[model samples]
Target: MVFARYLTPAAECGGLGLQCLGVGWQQVSRIQFDGRVIDCYGLMMIVRGTGWFVWGDLPRQRVPVQAPALFVVFPGVYHAYQPDAGGWSERWVLFNGPSAHTHEVLGTLDRDAPVMVLQGPLDGMERVFESLFEAADSSSPHRDVVTSSLVHRLLAELLAVKATTDVARVVRHFDEQATGPLSIGEHARRLGMDTPTLRREMFRATGTTPKDYILRTRLSMAQRLLLTTDRTVAEIARCVGYSDAAYFTRLFSRRVGQAPSHFRKVGRPRGRDG
Candidate 1:
């Protein structure tokens, strides 16, 4: 049997945030291929088969990649992956853009390490991938917005699989909380600590207090949404948890060095880079 689907994102999308360069599925039982270095990232998830993962000059590692496992290939990295006699079923997404560093900064992806054994079902990535496919296919008025949100969610989901740590936990909590509200004491209580203790520990670890950390997180998310979505300033302000659009606009302008509306249209201001 043969099954595969692919999509190339729109030009406006490439001009904005992380663009979904491509996506597809390969379900052949027997397979092998040598891939040369290129300027993008590719992820392959083994649905139901085993494979030998080979890299340049490295000893051929017999990777019996069980179902629901993912093998990642990053830009400028030469590699090869060949399924065993049993072959393998797989789905994948190829992506690149300025915002491609999300995974790296989050510490969830590594060039040296190319394999990721997933803990849950394999259809999740495919489902999100197909959402991207459909968005790119339809050329939705919100194509760039939809694609960016979907891709970001996809990467965040994959990153969630990595075991949590103090830093990761802190960052994750800050992200979730920063999206729609501001609550230090409440959040700290949920983390099982008093506000002062939480602030002290977070400061020791990240050089920033929980409040500052959450502010930076909110600003960063706002910047991303500004670049990506077609939403209005009031809408975005509320979405990021600010009921007062004027206040959100002023804060974003001061922190980002550009008004949210201007940033969305002109891309980071010239010579006013922050």
Candidate 2:
């Protein structure tokens, strides 16, 4: 049984200061990159089978079989692997270049820890990898442009999945209430539960209290307004649920580690802030 798929040579591409490398099931029995450095970042999708990942002395964690798992490895981190008896089959792309915003976007994950499991299938990754490989192997004048666009698409998918799993229910409520401010009491009412019960459930499901969840939700909105609009801090605060700008600033700084103004300067990229 082949555990790892070796990507075809045609799928390898180099340009835009980024080089894309991939392996399909036939490529090798196993693979490793950068020899477990602390700061290297990598995007890997398991195309088939079950496997385990061990990083930074953490116990080897089993990756669910048949479920697509996305892994982001940060620089200076040490990672090792052992495939299941069926062997872990996967597709991986490694690239570093000028427009390496993927690295920055991935930084959000890096701030907290080294391992994250994205909730999605690896079904579409093979095609994307194939296209990138072909573009790289071609001598066409538009090769870099085409490969860059594909890389962007791939990165977008990675970030999208990361965002989806990160916020969960809070994000659901935020989307439903995107048009205006949503009070915590009001949100609880909408969910058919009282404030206390809602708080309990939120904690049970997400490991965060309802109040903190709502605060983070609104703060996330406030962050967007700060970066993209000319809205005053007070207005943005009110838009998210805080009537007191000073209080909001305190809360934002507590959770985000920076004042709202500073966060605006830094911009909201995605993933956990602190």
**Model 1 Cα lDDT, one tens digit per residue, 69-176:** 777777877677778887888777777777667677655565544676666444556778778667756646776667677777777767755433334555667777
Task: State every prediction's TM-score relative to the real structure.
Answer: 0.52, 0.46
lDDT value for model 1: 0.69
Off by over 4 Å in 1: 1-11, 56-62, 120-126, 139-145, 164-274
Tens-digit lDDT track for model 2 on 1-274? 3332222223334345443443223322444432365433466666556656656546533333333565655556566654566666566655555456555745434433344455544335566777766776677776656766776667766666555554454446645574356567887666434677567656755688766666666777877788889999989888887788899888788777788888888875433653
In model 2, the Cα lDDT at residue 97 comes to 51
- Assess candidate 2 and give its TM-score to the true structure: 0.46
